[model samples]
Target: MRLMDSSEAITIKDVRSARRRLEGSARVTPLLEDPHLNAIAGRRVLVKAECLQRTGAFKFRGAWSALTALGEGARERGVITYSSGNHAQGIAHAAEELGIPATIVMPDDAPALKLANTRGYGAEVVLYDRAGGQSREEIGNRLAEARGLTPVLPYDEPLVIAGQGTAGLEIAGQARAMGVTKAEVLVCCGGGGLSAGMAVALAAEAPGLRVRTVEPAGFDDTARSLAAGERLGNEPGASSICDAILTPMPGELTFPILSRLAGPGLAVTDDEVLRTMGLAFQRLKLVTEPGGAVALAAALFHGAELADGPVVALISGGNVDTAMFRRALDMLDAAEPGAA
Candidate 1:
């Protein structure tokens, strides 16, 4: 699983191939702009609304890419993976659509909506205790071995990275259509799958658009690893409301791609994430989970750290529970002094 260099890893060619596979499956979500968001950032702000993606997240592209890439024999044999929420639902829905048996290992603390949706998509769900030192990888691996399930790793797999890159292809074309030639593309990074994939795509399709990884404050492993010029893991037991992007470290394959093509990473606080989530619904009428809002949070609050140009922020997912959405909406007053 070693990607020693960028050349050996996923490339633009791989991303293009993935786009072909995803032609009728994955949605090319919208690239949106609002004057209110621009006024808040004091610059042009474009939002890649991946929350509108199927299963309420962009993970579907990767799920379809990985599952379909497997031979028919393997697909009939079933597949397994681990995720907090978004990836779980994505894999589940894609599996259901393809009529493949799928199993997902999710933390017990995952959002209620995500857990329900994953199961509703007809996959068997296994719950693990994330805060109690239980390893989802170990659980998934054991289950996979016992059930003869082919493993579809959430981010580390090359096919998954390539599939996520299709979004980058769309972003390049959409931004260009909007007359944005150069800008920073902010991505909410968990294990660097989406950001790395997008970097690969943008490097070839839109060289002027650069990617910047965004993470919740305490879980900013990707940002720290980029700064250190090597892989770095988050502190043990570090926690945040942004559960979707909380990974122990970056993926082995994705880090090299990110290090090569991505700009410096960024981190945002849970408060900022909540505010962004609130503002997204209020202004753009888009529901965003905390983890999914980190990129948008950086776009609005960390503008000083961004390059001088239009900012493209990816709202990575939107599978939030009612209570969490209410909590985010409650923060609207603090997010803007006079907003209702």
Candidate 2:
């Protein structure tokens, strides 16, 4: 396939194609309405529960989309990728279903459940130290070259971004079914694939909808990059409990689309994320990881600044370690009355 210009790489047509590719393979995760969340935001709040998606996250949609787009020869040659957790599981699961060999290079500190699930999905796992000055992309690429395998990036590629856009299509349709004409969407921002892809889909399908990328406080590179009108990187040593969305920089391909279509970004602290996760479990009856709940955090805490109409928050994943989940619950328990 001939490569399109970066700006045009992931178009509405591509997203629509991805939706068709994902028709039976990917679940149309529910758009949940939470009275408690609505009460908190003081407006209608719809939650896209991608946590309940296959492989426990929306990454599966993009993974399947990218893999299906590859030629048969490439599929036989295998695929490799680097991810903190959710993307790893997505790729692994897709590869397994396609009878393709898959390998994932994951951070040593990735959530235990995500690591286990990625391996359980039949991918070879290679753990790398995030603090050891080792580059995950370099390692994954080197491995791909050695094994003659295709390199599937966690974000940045057009196929993957288009695949992620499938979720946006569902959101638009579901919102319309719920009688929502205009709304702002809050998506967890990592390297911008999901946010950028959703922007494209919503632009075509729900022109009245606005998109905002949400990130952890210390690692809000996408947020800052949008404000600076250029790509930017986060501090190398910056850390957060929201490990799933801890990408160091905005993706080169995804940023341009996001810059053109997305609204100002928003961020929330780790404490807020944990509290939101706890609230999701208690109120929404949904298990949400810190990273997945950041968008919800922004909605609950910064909704007024983000939008005035109905707000849709994307809960991107739910791959939290048991201990960490318990800690989040503990934090909720210890909070001041009515804090959660």
Candidate 3:
């Protein structure tokens, strides 16, 4: 149980105390915007959505900020992790609304509607064998040490990266109430917990907002471990229909907070994440899930590696199924014949 150790010092006051313990238990989700994705990313894109959060994704604000910041005798001695489905239904619906007792460890090629909605939020899933290498974090730390439990680390801990940086503090106050002083956000990452917890809450509340991280192409190991500054790995059988951001590396505490607050990491292309999950269900109806449309497929096909302001992105999950949302509306009606 002595797990946390990547220097443990998450800041932005632990994402504003996990957004004041997720005010009324998380769900500030929407940010949307769409002028046909801002005229196809010529700028101003937005999106945040978080797959309409709540158990749909954004890993339930770091699984309810790591199980209500534990320690009521470690939430009654029950918890455990490892996921391949929106943090296993955000730690099985925040350990069944705090009654605790979870135990995910999924990935038998997950996404059977996220293993039946993580067993309909009752937890106790345990599948393993992700393409046979087999380790859902060593079978969720050997069944959380044979059931003593308490682990909730779906992304290098620190209260689950300050509960995924409270959705980057609600996307920096909804992109500064949409006046958006400056932008680039884009997240859909994997083991680098919500893009290193939204680049440590947009480097402390939108320092002209940055955070990047999308991924998919051969599980772009956090976009080549943020272009080889160190941590790298994903190639041993490398596969991806965007299986929830695929993770083969990038987490020893989310790579030094995504190499000191991210940017320069993007990869997309499971056919551009099924055409950005068919352009987020034909223009903002939203329902993404090829690993949440790889940050809106890098805000609609990597606009020349971005950098002129206004982007956002972050659709991070929607659970998807039904023949993969009918192959993402048949690849957005073969790339927009009548636009799906």
1 against 3, candidate with superior TM-score: 1
RMSD of 3: 16.5
The best-first sequence of candidates by TM-score reads 2, 1, 3
* Cα lDDT tens digits for candidate 2, 1-340: 2123455667899999999999899999999998878888898889999999998889999999989888888888899999999999999999999999999999897878888999999999999998787899889878887888888888887888999999999999999999996989999999999999999999999988889999999899999999999999997777899888988889999999999999999999998898899989998889988889999999998865776788999996878888889988999899899866
What's the TM-score of every candidate structure? 0.96, 0.96, 0.37
Q: What total of clashing residue pairs does each candidate reach?
A: 0, 0, 0
lDDT string, candidate 1, 116-215, tens digits: 9999999999999988889999998898889888888888888888999999999999999999989999999999999999999999999999999999
All candidates: CA RMSD in angstroms? 2.1, 1.7, 16.5
List candidate 2 segments past 4 Å from native: 1-8
lDDT of 3 by residue, 195-236 (tens): 887788888788888888888887777777778888888887
Clashing pairs for predicted structure model 2, backbone only: none
Worst 10 residues of 1 by lDDT: 1-10
